[model samples]
Target chain A: MKWALSLCLLLSVGLIFTPNTLHALPEESGKAELWLTKMSTAFSELNFRGLVVYGDGDHWESLEYRQTQHKGTHLSRTQYLSGIPRTQVRSGNELFCIHSGDHIAGLTPDVFKPLNRDLASKLTTILASYEVGVFSNIERIAANDAVFITLTPKSDDRYAYQLWLERTTGLPLKADLLDIKGDVLQRFQFAELELNVTTPISMFSSSESGHALRLKPTPDRVSSSEASWWPAWLPSGFALQGYNKVSGSEGRQGERLTFSDGLSSFTVFVDHVENDLGPDLTRRWHATSATVRHTRSNTGDFRISVVGELPSVTVSKIAESVTLVDQLASR
Target chain B: MTDRKNESLSALCDGECDELEVRRVLNQFSSDPDLREQWRRYHLLGSIMREEPVSSIDLSEGIMQALDGEPMDEVPARSQTPVETSVAHTAADNKRSRSQWLMSGAVAASVTLAVLVGARFAYDPSALDGSMSGAALVMNDSQSAMESEAISAITVAANEPVVEPLTVANADISAEELRKAQEVLSQYVLEHENEAINANEQGLPTFVRVANFGADNKTAVRKD
Candidate 1:
């Protein structure tokens, strides 16, 4: 009787502690999420410089990338090595670009914040749209051991992403953008990387002869509700990020609405047209698609365009769904 | 799987495998479970290398089973009708000619505004010198003098009416119309990228995109 009881106890303990059961748990995904979190933190916390090759199937460019954090401020510089001479410097939220003696300055989001906070807060939102996975195989990238991570789209509306992160530092060494068919549409990979190197702050400055052009962020006051026209349908998970009304010569005006789904984004532009009523046009540049549609409304002849790094079909659908607020009300 | 076979599979994933190699891979793929598993891993690895979502499930077994149930016969090749071939050639020719026209026309039209603006800045580089402080001041007031000047330049170019009549018969678009469309599209794309740089948590991809697209900060300065 005692032997039977002990056997029952042993069976129960074995079921609880089985290796397969432990392996089948969320440990793998949890480790992936943890690695992703580390990568996010590494971007702001680590100092690195490398030669990177970026391509969009149609075109490719080589660039020198350098990043460092100094006195609580994150700074990075990207200098094109293969193409037309251009340099972009980012100091905290301010971005300065120097090209052909022209200096362009603009503000970006607060990128200095350790990105892990944002990732942790929005993991649920992101997981809703993408399935995260970690590959068991260890790959060598940028001459360093790396682990592969993937964010697969739950739907066909968005593209998938694969990243190879350095195993030790968690810094991303390579990334690929995949279309729905699993073909690589774009790729950014590091050929050589040196971490923990000193990057001088002077590298982020523009020459005195460079012309300074400042670009302001979109005004926060112009909400989608106040827009004269808006997209009737957006792919799931997309939300309006900003809106702006632009005035051209001859009293002509246009509106721009931007939307993002955390990882992907697209913009809608509506402008008044006067002449040359051409048929609809679709243009592809790299992975980005630009679709233009001409629509005549009671107000005037308008040109609507949807542009983004999305599939051509998605942009066309978005372009077709734009409607004037008044037209919506009348309908 | 042999290393040679693995290389063939990788080439197939990249769409580089020739027909003979494709046939060989497909043959081995159907009969060997290990090869099938390797195929799945190769796809998953390919997805990861491409920075896309990975799918681990292998659906080829069911597909091959279904294919096995179908009757196999030597299918006759169907040649395109002469009329169909002529239509295809005509369409291709039209596309080639229209693109050729656009190449030169767009250059001339786009350069006009660029030269005008370039000359203005070239004549007085100092006008843009104090733009840093000017931008700081403009932050408080959205309608700044600098912004108006930039906006006026763009508006002047944008308001220029299309001179050529619409070629409705041939469906050929006018250069002015195409130029305007390009300008509008480029502006929105730039703005979208700017916002993306702000919104995206991933740091390097945005920089890669900006570099890939050639940071044309000249037009980025005009928006209010």
Candidate 2:
């Protein structure tokens, strides 16, 4: 009887802990960090070609995407498929836009900015505000089986996320942005993907008609910190990533402050305009929305716009909180 | 059933009908059970007569079933570029296959047939005209649908596409607002898109590729 009771106790103990172990989050294994790190590195490391499809409300679009790193220069091309021909090719820090017969190259210094440390540091910002867990769910994308990682935010400042990482390559083949209600706000996924495909030199060549337009020089960029302004309040988990002051021709000046919670980010642009062209126009692209609000500050008429994947109302609140502190006062 | 209705079904089976009759028959497909039954029977009879082994080739029901059972979160599309340049894909495909086998005979002949038809379409310059706008396929919530859909399968190999015109999902905006929005939006979008896309962050890069200046729309897949 004593031996039998001991055996029963062991069986009960095994049953008691088995479910908990099976259902355990990846916190212990650190697989969440591993998966996220893989996702961040996959794009730069892998040379691939694929089509990405996304749609919202009415307009849905697909694009042919090609990414390659030649001589340490990353040449990624995004070609729009459904409409008139407009293409953007990002080679290192320059974004070359070819439309119709016009070739406009806008230099982006931001891309070359040393990744705010490694991708891990950037992820740490997100991990600070979000809880990472593996759903133990797998789905097929681009004919590859992808495992799902659910990012539940530690705070409600941002939306929840579910990233589908291809197991073999650890690349993110698909991602969905969900609302507080857990409804999907946007989805960006690769419908057809072939990795390690040899990209032709001409594929990265300029427009179909190589007749060239002048490469547009970047408007002057100053620091956003010099703008002598800061938001008195911001959503939880959001921090000032960076800001730049922009000066275009004819002396039009604007300062932009960027904030990020790792997963979601928004830019506040205080552009000085000649006229009152401020309409709160909101555009949703995939999961991100750009809401532009025109307002007037003490200096003159300014258009304060917030562009992000976050809710318009939430961003609007951030926009309303922009206060111009004298650059001198902060010191 | 009236003989006239039966005749209409026969014509529809034969792939002959004006817009009016096509609409009428299409309407009948949903409302009239007798019409549907007759339609099925007519196709069945024709298949038997033709001596072509009959098959349940319909996939709409399967597609609907798949859609119904599917969980909403995961779906993907083609590259950031997509256009109806199925013609381009077809052309590149020919070059691709021929170059693959210029010196070797190991490649299958079926690939040759597909290339030939694709080449024919590619050679027609008018098909390449900017004016020829077929309804670009909208892919939502089903990357798997690409495997089942022949057109998308063909498009996967298409190449050298034009940039897409600025179009938004929100269609309620007037053309003026859209134009203005595009002007204001594009100016900001370039800077913001650059900021959002670059510097090795996966989240922003993914969002920017799928949003802002979006991917080509034609070769994309949809997920709900």
Residue range A1-331, candidate 1, lDDT tens digits: 9999999999999888554312322236688778877877788688989766555432334567788988898888877643345676777766666665222222222212222224554566666777887765566665577776778788898788777788888887777666776555566666567899998788877665332333244454446777988788888887786776665435677777888665667888887766644557676554567777888988878878788878878888898899988877887
- Per-residue lDDT of candidate 1, residues B33-93 (tens digit): 7777556544332232233333344433322322243222332222321110000011012
Candidate 2 on A1-331: residue-level lDDT in tens? 9999999999999888553324534554388888778776777777888766543212234567888878887777777653445676766655555655322222211221222114555787778888887656455655667776777777665677666777877776666556665555544556567788778756776665433222223233334546656766788788777766655335666677787776677878776665544345665544455666655667776666676657656766776677677733565
TM-score of chain A of each: 0.82, 0.73
Cα lDDT for residue B193, candidate 1: 54
Q: Using TM-score, give the best candidate's number.
A: 1
Q: List the candidates' TM-scores in order.
A: 0.56, 0.53
lDDT value for candidate 1?
0.55
Q: After aligning candidate 2 to the native by TM-score, how far in Å is the CA of A30 from where it should be?
A: 1.2
Clash count in backbone of candidate 2: 54
Candidate 2 regions off by >4 Å? A1-29, A101-121, A207-224, A248-252, A273-286, A289-298, A327-331, B1-191, B194-224
